[model samples]
Structures are given as C-alpha cells and as structure tokens.
Target: MDFGLVLLLLGGFLLGGAWSIWRADSDTEGRTGPQVVFAVILLTAALLASVSGILYLV
Candidate 1:
C-alpha cells in the first residue's frame, strides 16, 4: 500500500468521524463547544491530509 493511499484512507475516516461528531453535537442541547471545536479541528486536518495525499499521488 502506498503511503499516499494510506493517507487518503485516513483522511476519509477522519472526515467521517468529524461529520458524525458535528451532527451529534448539533442534535444535543446547549454547551457542546468543545465537541464543536474538536470536530472543526478534525475536519481541517482531514482536508489537509486529503490534499497532501492527492498531491503526493500526482
């Protein structure tokens, strides 16, 4: 398995997790600040990883 492919898979997994967390937090009541922040961070990381993976493959 190429490292780029691995990174792409990891990014997809992280993106899914971040989306789940964001959705769950949105459905909950007040004071989910930390979860939201974490989700955003995860989302950012995922995007960066995915971009890097694509670049690497190219």
Candidate 2:
C-alpha cells in the first residue's frame, strides 16, 4: 500500500470537505466561488502530488 497516496487523498478530502462545509455554513453567499476554487486547488494539488509520488515509487 502507498502511504503517501493515502495521506494525500485523506488530507485533500478533509481540507476540501472543510472548505465546502465552512462556506455552506457561512452567511455569506457571495463568497462560495472562492471556496470552491480553494477546494479544487487543494484537491488537485494533493492528487497530483500523490500520483507523482506513487509513480516515482513504482
């Protein structure tokens, strides 16, 4: 099993979920676009880093 991938995915998931939830719970409706952008940023960064790390190991 790839531990780095696991960590990256879990971290991304937690961060993205937190970002969305935080945005949803907030009273500000106009800022969701930024929140979604942030979530995508974190998710993609984590995913790319994980894939590359795994590929390197493999």
Candidate 3:
C-alpha cells in the first residue's frame, strides 16, 4: 500500500496505454523508427511495473 508503488504502477499503466495508442497510429501512418523503439520500451516498463505491483501487493 505504499503510495510510491501505487504511483509507479499507475504511471506505467498509463504510459503503456499511451504508447500503445501511438504505436497503433504510427503503424497506420506507416512510420517505423523512433516511435517503434519508444513503444517497445514503454511496453517493457509497463510489464515490469505490473509485476512489481503484484509482488508489492502480495
């Protein structure tokens, strides 16, 4: 129940979702460069955040 942990998870979730949207947009626009790299990084961070959150809750 640490506030910092909660913030971490929330931030990760939001960033992941935002990146997902942007990734989709980039895909539709046919651009493959920094956006793709950023999307990957965000998704990875999101996954780590979710796992850490679950562990913290336990």
TM-score to true structure, per model: 0.87, 0.52, 0.60
- After TM-score superposition, what is the CA distance of residue 6 in candidate 1 from its true location, in Å? 0.5
What overall lDDT, based on C-alpha atoms, would model 2 receive against the true structure? 0.65
Model 2 misses residue 56 by how many Å? 0.9
lDDT of 1: 0.89
Lowest summed-lDDT stretch of 10 residues in model 2? Answer: 21-30
What is the Cα-based lDDT of residue 56 in candidate 3?
A: 69
Give the per-residue lDDT of model 3 (tens digit) for 1-58: 7965895768577686756756576435675677677777777777777677767667
For candidate 3, the TM-score is 0.60
* Candidate 2: tens digits of C-alpha lDDT, residues 2-51: 77667666666666665664467456555567666766777676677666
* Residue pairs with clashing backbones, model 3: none
Top TM-score hit: 1
What's the lDDT of the predicted structure labeled candidate 3? 0.70
Worst 10 residues of 1 by lDDT: 22-31
lDDT of 1 at 7: 88
Highest lDDT model number: 1
* Runs in model 3 lying further than 4 Å from the true structure: 1-12, 15-29
- RMSD score of candidate 3 (Å): 3.4
